[model samples]
Target: MTPIRHNGSGSGSDNDHVLDAVRDCVLAVGVRRTTLADVARRAGVSRMTLYRRWPDLRSLVGDLMTREWIDVATRAMAEPAPGTATRTRIVDGLVAGVGAFRAHPLFRKIVDVDPELLLPYVLDRRGASQEALLALLADALREGHADGSVRPGHTERQARVLLLTVQSFALSLRTMTDEDDPELDSAALLGELRTLLERTLTP
Candidate 1:
């Protein structure tokens, strides 16, 4: 997904304020509760200005999720790492993505009340995040296969399976016991994930 270059009116400060307000509102009230009027009031921007820029709540939320949150995940995936260690990168990326999602209250609320909200995004029809993440993993897997460092076959299908695994792990977090440590669970899950990938990619 192309990073959104927010070329808002006036100055960078105003743009930053708007973004901050949107994020704050979403985190506080969730995606369903947040309104353009509320955002305009919170940001101290006129309703006309907010409307002119975002047009609708869905557009604003989509832009915020795509431009801000997903970009962070994409950059994390793009960082210089042991690309040859296919299992390590993919598991680490998935674990980190789950951690990031948990930290976002908006996501937590949606996933808690109605996970269906994520289907459109996860199914890759609503936004670019899913497609970008899938492509990233698929490309990484393909590269590993090409170099003979990782076994090859059904790279795209494997990527999708890994994606589903990550989602399942995240959704299962809520059912964990109080004794469970999220970090430890994440590490264990990722390790198992690496083992699975190893089996798949290592003939």
Candidate 2:
């Protein structure tokens, strides 16, 4: 996902207001039904204002997703117990991130109503958000290696593999879950994910 260039003049708060409108519109009618006019109206800005910032609805939505997902990952990574080992922090952050994404309203909305929008990122190529996440994971892995907590390897490759594993669980966990069976429920599966990640990163 290329970063959405804001060629227009606006404060950060102004941009946030527009994004808030977009989010509300998406939550109400999804991506297909949303229009520039709708966003402009809801945001109390002209369509030209939005046009200057984003070329199309897809680009706007892409930026929105990037903002949302990064925030989720950042929050998760920041909240681990103090003085935790690098490996433990990495594993706990990822598990918490998976859970956060699974429970996020916007994420649930996109998955339920605009899942096809995600297919390109999943199947064809990496997006900006995915690249950002990979960078974060790679950095953490490097720190883990320095601390003798993670196995020695190519940090980038290890990060990519960790991402692939967590991505699968985040996107597909619901499909495999059995609400009636506690052993197969989401929490149970997430625990398994935590264990898998810890083992993978541990020396």
Candidate 3:
């Protein structure tokens, strides 16, 4: 279920421009309406340049998601705070990953504009972003398990479950009925999510 990331060109600038174009186009007119020509126009690049990087819109979007999520996971792991317990680190990392998905503008745009576009990545195959996230989780879960701070299940399986939970809430919150929505404050949301994660890792 691992999805490959489509590396842009030799220059980081091309990737940035192309990804920026895709994000701008999606925000402006949704994924379905976004085209290579439009992306090129927005990026001030020729269609040839865009094609050289991505065969189509789907490929571009996949890589864009990967880059963004990699940034999210990288940032989360960078600061572990002194003396953080392994299980606590797992919870914190999960919450941080969820926050990234929640706070990302492009993610929000996709959720609001074309939610269906997110289904494949969620239900079927694990794309580059999913793999990146899972790897990060796996590393943390292994550390937790080794220290006897986490549950006894396979680290990869536990990571997958945590990832699914995070993705579900991050992507499907809009589907909640008005009365069903918790409407909790930020602290409450993460606190509840952390509790749920903690129970699975504890006796």
List lDDT for all candidates, in order: 0.65, 0.87, 0.77
Off by over 4 Å in 2: 1-10, 79-82
Clashes of each: 0, 2, 0
Using all chains and alpha carbons, the TM-scores for the candidates as numbered come to: 0.70, 0.93, 0.84
Which sections of candidate 3 miss by over 4 Å?
1-3, 177-189
So what's the TM-score on candidate 1?
Answer: 0.70
Q: 94-130 in candidate 1: lDDT tens per residue?
A: 6677667666666676666546656664455525555
Query: What clash pairs does model 3 have?
Result: none
Residues 3-76, candidate 3: write the lDDT tens digits: 57666564887688788888888888888888989998999989988888787888888777777778876776
How do the residues 86-191 of candidate 2 rate in per-residue lDDT, one tens digit apiece? 8988988999999998898888998899899889878888888899999999988988899888999999999999999999999999999998999999999999
- Model 1 pairs whose backbones collide: none
